[model samples]
Target: MIVVTTPTGQIGSQLVHRLLDQDKEVRVIVRDASRLEDTVRERVETVEGSHDEPGVLDEALPGAEALFWLVPPSRQAPSVREYYLGFARVGAAAVARHGVGHVVGVSSAGHGWPTPAGVLSAAFAMDAELGASGAAYRALSMPFYMENLLGQLDAIRGPGAFHLTCAGDLPLASIATRDIAGVAADLLTDLSWTGQRNLPVFGPDRLTPDGMAEVISQELGRPVTYRRMSMDDYASLLRSRGAGDQQVKDMTEAFAAQDHGIYDADWATAEPTSTDFRTWCREVLRPAADA
Candidate 1:
C-alpha cells in the first residue's frame, strides 16, 4: 500500500488520482478525509490528522510500502525552519519505525545549495532527513509552480497590471502540479525501493514572470503588463494584507534570492506534461474569470 501526506492539496490530489488509476491500494493522511471527492475517498483509505500532530504519522506509516511526503505552507509557525525540521524528524522516525520500503518526498529546487534561501530552509531540511532515512527515497526537487501565477490572475482579468517583486526576469522552471504527482505515482508503482536519489522535475520550457504576462494576454484577449516592485514595497503590500512582519521578511528575502540568480542550477529533465501553461490557462483560469 502507498501512503500519501497532504492528500487534499494540489499535488497530493493529483497523486491520489494517479494511484487510483493504477489500482494501487492507497492511504492518505488528511485533516478531513470527507473533504475529498467521493471518487478519491472511495479509492483510498483515509487517516485523519495533520502532519504536525504528534504520533499521527506513526499510526499512518505501518504496513505502507511507499510514502509520498510534503510539508504544506503554513503561516502559524513561529519559525518556519524549526517547524519544517520538526516535521521532518517525526516523519523520519515514523518511516524508520515502520520499515516503509520507499519514500518519495516533494521538495524545492536548489535544495542542494549549501547557502540556504532564508525561510525556504525547510526544503533543504526535508531533503536531509529524507536522505538520512534508510528507506528507498526519492527527493523530487521542483521549480516554482505555474499555479503560483494564480495570484496574478485577478489583475489579468481586471484593469490593473500584474505585479512581481522579482528584478530582471526570473527564468523559472515552472512545472504543473499534475506532472509532479504523475512522477511520484510512477516512482511508487514502477520500481523497488532504493536508497535516496534527488530528481529535478523541470518542465519542458523555462518562463519568466514577464513571459507569463504574455501567456495571460493571449488567453485573456488583453495586454497584461508585468511590473516589478521593490522588495520593501512588496513587503509593505504583504503587511497591508495582514501578513506579519516575519512573513513579509521571508517573502522579501525569497524574492531577493531570485533576483540574485540563486536557483539557476541545472534542472533535471522530467517526464512530459500534457497540460502546459496555455492549456492550464484555457481550462482553469478562463473559468475562474467567470466566477
Candidate 2:
C-alpha cells in the first residue's frame, strides 16, 4: 500500500488517479472525505484527519510500502517555514517508525540560495529530514507551476493577460503539475533507485511571462499580454483576494527573490522536459478559460 497525502488537491488527486491506474494498492489521508469523489473513497483506504497531527501517520503509514508527501498550502499559517517543518518532523518520525522504504515528496528548486526562499525553504528542510531517515527518497524538485496561472483565470479572460511582479522578459523555470504527478507516480511505483536525490522537473521550454503570454495568445487565437505589476500592488491584490497576513509576507518575499533573479539558475540546470507552456495552455488553460 502507498499512502498519499493531500488526496483532494490538484497534484495529489492526479497522483492518486495515476497510481490507481497502475493498479497499486492506495491509501489516502484527507481531512474531509466529502471532498473526494465516491470512486476514490471507495477504492482507497481512507483516514480522515490532518496529516500533520502526531498520530495521524501511525494509523496511515503502517503496512504502506511507499509514501507520497506534499505539504498543502496553509493561508493562515503563522510562519510558513515553521508550519512546514512541524509537519515534516512528524512525517519523518512516522516514516522511521513504520520502516517505509521509499518516499516521493513534492519539493522545489533553489536548494541553498543566499536569499529568503519563502515557503520553498520548507521543502528543502523536509527533504533533508526525510533523506536522513534512510528511506529511498526522491525529492521531486519543480519550479513555479504553470497551473498557478489558473488562479488568475479571471485576469486572463478579462484583461487578456497574466500578471506578475517579476520581469516579464526574463525567462524562468516552470512545470506542469500533471508532469510532476506523472513522474512522482512512476517513482513511487518502483523501488529501483535507492538513497536520496533531487529530480528536476522543469517543463520543456524556458519561457518568460511575456513569452508565455505570446504562446497563450497564439493558442487561444487572441491577444494576451504579461503585465508586470509593482510589488506593493501585487501584495495589495493578494490581500484583496482574502490572503492572510503571513501569506502576504511570504509572497512578498517570494516576489522579491524573483525580482532579484534568484530562480534564474533553475533554468540553467533544468531537467529533461515534456510539456511546455504552449501545450499546457492548449491542454489545461484553454479549457479553464472556456469554463
Candidate 3:
C-alpha cells in the first residue's frame, strides 16, 4: 500500500490519479473524504483526518510500502518554522514506526541558500527532519510554482496584468504543479532507489516576469503587463486580505529571498522538466483566463 497526504490538493489530486492509473494500491489521509471525487473515493482506502495529527498517520501508515508527504499551509500558525516542522516531526515518527520503505516529500529548492527564506526555509527544515527518518527519502525540490498566477486571475482579467514583489527583469524559474505531481508519482511507484536526496523538478523556461507578461498577452490575445509591487505594499495587501502578522512577515521574507536568487544556483544546473512556460500558459493559464 502507498499513502498520500493532502490528497485533494492540486498536486496531490493529480498524483493520486497517476498512481491509480499504474494500478498501485493507494490510501489517502484527508480532512474530508467527501471532497475527493466519487470515483477516486471509491477506489482508494480513505483515512479521514489531518495528516499532521499522529492518530491519522498511525492508522494510515501501517503496511504501507511508500508515502507521499506534503505539509498543508497554515496561515494562523505563530511561527512558520514550527508549523512546518510540527508536521514533519509527526511524519518522521510515523515513517519509522511503520517501517515504510520509501518517502517522497514536496519541498522548495533553496537547500544551501545563504539567507533566510521564510516559508522556503521552513520547508528545508522539514526536509532535514524527514531525512533523518530510517525510510529512504526523496525530497522533490522545486522553484516557483506557475499556478501561483491563478491567484491573480482577477487582476489578469480586470487590468490585463499580474503583480509580484520580485524584480520584473530577473529570471524566475518555475514549474507547473502537474509536472511536480508526475515526478512524485514516478518516484513513489519505483521504490528501488535508496537513501536521501533532493531531486530538482524545474521547467524548461527561464522567463522574467516581463517576458511572462509578453507570453500571457500573446497566448490570451490581450495586452497583459507585469507590475512590480513594493514589499511594503505587498505586505499591506496581504494584511488587507486577512493574513496574520507572522504569515505576512514570512511571505515578505520568501519574496525577498526569491529576489536575492535563492533558486538561481540549483536551477542553473538541473535538468529541466517537460513543461515550458508558453505551453503552461497556453494549456493552463489561457483556459483559466477564458473562464
Candidate 4:
C-alpha cells in the first residue's frame, strides 16, 4: 500500500488519480476526509489526520510499502521553515518507525545549492531531512508551477493584460501539476532502485513572462499585453495579498535569484513533460477565463 500526504493539493490530487487509474492500492492522509470529493474519498483508504500529529501517523504509516510525503504550506505559521521542519522531523521519524521503504518528496529547484534560496529554503531543508532519513527517497525538483500563472487570469480575461516582476526575458522552466503527478504515479508503481534520487522535470520549452503572454494571447485569440511591474509595485501587491515584510522580501529575493540563474542546476536526470504553456493556456487557463 502507498500512502500519500496532501492528497487534495494540485500535484497530490493528480498523483492519487494516476495511482488509482493504475489499480495501485493507495491510502491518503488528509486532515479532513470530507474535503475530498465523493469518488476520490471512496476509491482510497482515507487516513483522516494531519502529518504533524505523530498519533495520526502511527495509525496511518504502518504496513505501507512506499509513501509520497509532502508538507503543505500554511500562512498562520511563524515561518514556512519552522512550520515545514516540524512536520518533516515527525515524518522522518514516521518513515523510520513504519519501515516504509520508498519515499518520493516534492521539492523545489536548486535544492542543495549553497547560497540562500529565499522562499525555496524550506524545500532545501526537506531534501536534507529526507536524505538523512535512510528511507529510499527521490526528491522531485519541480520548476515554477504553471498554476502560479493562474492568478493573472483575472487581468488576462478582464483587461487582457498581465503584469510580472521579472525583467529582461527571464527563461522559465515551468511544469504542469498534472505532469508532476504522472511522474509521481510512475515512481510509486515502479520502485526499481532508489537511495537518494533527484528528477529535474521541465516543460517542452522555456519562455519568458512576456513570451508567455504572447502565447496566451494567441491561444485565447485575443490581444494580451505584458508589462513588468517595478519592485515597489510588486512589494505593494504582495502586501495587499496579505504577505508581511519577510514574505515579500523572500519572494523578491527568489525572483532576483531566478533571474541570475541561481536555480538552474543539473539534475540527476531530466523528465521533459509534454504540457507547454500554449497548450496549458488553451486547455486549462482559457476555460477558466471564459468561465
Q: Pick the candidate with the highest lDDT.
A: 3
Top model number, TM-score: 3
Which residue pairs of candidate 2 clash? none
162-226 per-residue lDDT for model 2 (tens digits): 88887888886788999999998888888799988888778888688889989989988889899
Tell how far residue 42 is off in model 1, in angstroms.
2.0
Query: TM-scores of all models?
Result: 0.92, 0.94, 0.98, 0.94
- Report RMSD for candidate 4: 1.8
**lDDT measured at residue 73 in model 3 versus the true structure, 0 to 100:** 80
**lDDT by residue for model 1 over 1-291, one digit each (tens)?**
899999989899989988898899999899998899997898788889987665787778878889899998887766667877888888887888888889999987675565547565667787788778778888887766777767776776786467777743766566788889988999999767577777878677667777877887788777877888888788888788788776776667666765665556736445545667777767777677657
Order candidates by lDDT, high to low.
Answer: 3, 2, 4, 1
By summed lDDT, the worst window of 10 consecutive residues in model 1 runs over 266-275
Error of 3 at 192 (Å): 1.3
> Counting only residues 3 or more apart in sequence or on different chains, how many pairs clash (N, Cα, C under 3 Å) in candidate 1?
0
Model 4 misplaced stretches (Cα beyond 4 Å)? 267-269
lDDT of 4: 0.81
lDDT of 3 at 197: 94
lDDT values, one for every candidate: 0.78, 0.86, 0.93, 0.81
- In candidate 1, the residue pairs with backbone N, CA or C atoms under 3 Å apart (3 or more residues apart, or in different chains) clash, namely none
Arranged by TM-score, best first: 3, 2, 4, 1
Full-model lDDT, candidate 2: 0.86
RMSD of each: 2.0, 1.6, 0.9, 1.8
Query: What are the clash counts of all predictions, listed in order?
Result: 0, 0, 0, 0
Model 2 regions more than 4 Å off: 241-246
Report the Cα lDDT for residue 15, model 2.
95
